[model samples]
Target: MINNTIVQELIHEIVKEEEGVPVVECLMEGSITDEEIAEKTHLKLNTVRKILYKLYDAGIASYKRSKDPETQWYTYTWKFESEKIEEIIKKRNQEIIENLREMLAFEENNMFFACKNGHYRYTFDEAAENNFRCPECQEELEYMDNSEIIQQLKRELSLYENNGSEIAFNFKSYS
Candidate 1:
């Protein structure tokens, strides 16, 4: 599994930077009134109202309104849903795995060549385009064996396969 500390930190950082920190925090705590959130966050009432509206529209949080008998103004309360955070993190993990696969394929299968006398290497096409001659030594270029590259790619893919499911599971647990 991915480290719980890393996952928790990522979640905290994302939520903290969200436009309505007070609303999010209050919602996470339980249903809380807008005025209470504003007071706790040290933000103006109008600003807190705007933040609540935005959070509601984003579907990251929701609210209920209760009419105050003394003033007749609707008091807004909020709550956060855990599912949305899980969905976002799961999508990110899928993208990372796809990118890793693409990189491994490129590293393992793409043809390469290198100059015997120097440390330079080129792809098969590059060597052919250069008349099979090393630009530095004027020596003929030959196809480099790719077994080592393929082996390394296999190793990396194995690591990903081993860890990817656990990472995804941990991310879900956080949500």
Candidate 2:
């Protein structure tokens, strides 16, 4: 898709600004050698290679290796995979949504009580067995208001879901 905005954001999330600079520039170019990337990004060659390797390990980048015929120096040319980035972000967002949903379900289905003194939460059965008192401070337990927390989780979940849909995979070959 020849996109730089989304690729820059994704690289920034994966690496430091300095590291992300080269990665974003080179990645948008489809593919480039580490040396060229370093020169273009104004970074040290070793730094560029290290950052590229890290991205590759994360499956955000891929590379092809070749050897110079004369010097026999092995060189790797890398390309940032936009398709993989979208998949990673979407997967992570879905995982977060799942966790939030589980928490919301728990909060809605369970009756929770809290100690007025220490703010410790306990299930209804625990509170009742303890005579509606705080086990630690011996203070009276009150009904815990988790509505705000539930609402917040719901909002976050919705945001993630919405953001997940923002990226449309073009699946076009950069090469």
Task: Per model, state how many residue pairs clash.
Answer: 0, 0
Candidate 1 segments exceeding 4 Å error: 1-9, 12-25, 43-59, 63-76, 113-122, 126-160, 167-175
| Candidate 2 residue lDDT tens string, 63-158 | 999999999999888887767876776677688889989988988888989998876899899899999999798999999888998898899888
lDDT of candidate 1 over 1-175, digit per residue (tens): 1135654444445544443544565667778887888888888888777766655665556778789999998877777765665555556657766877887787676788889987588877788889989988889887888788778767776776666677667766754
Model 2's TM-score against the true structure: 0.80
Q: Tell me the whole-model lDDT of each prediction, alpha carbons only.
A: 0.69, 0.77
Error of 1 at 161 (Å): 3.6
Model 2 local distance difference test score? 0.77
Residue 4 displacement (Å), model 1:
4.6
Candidate 2 shows a clash count of: 0
As a TM-score, model 1 comes out at: 0.54
Estimate TM-scores for all models.
Answer: 0.54, 0.80
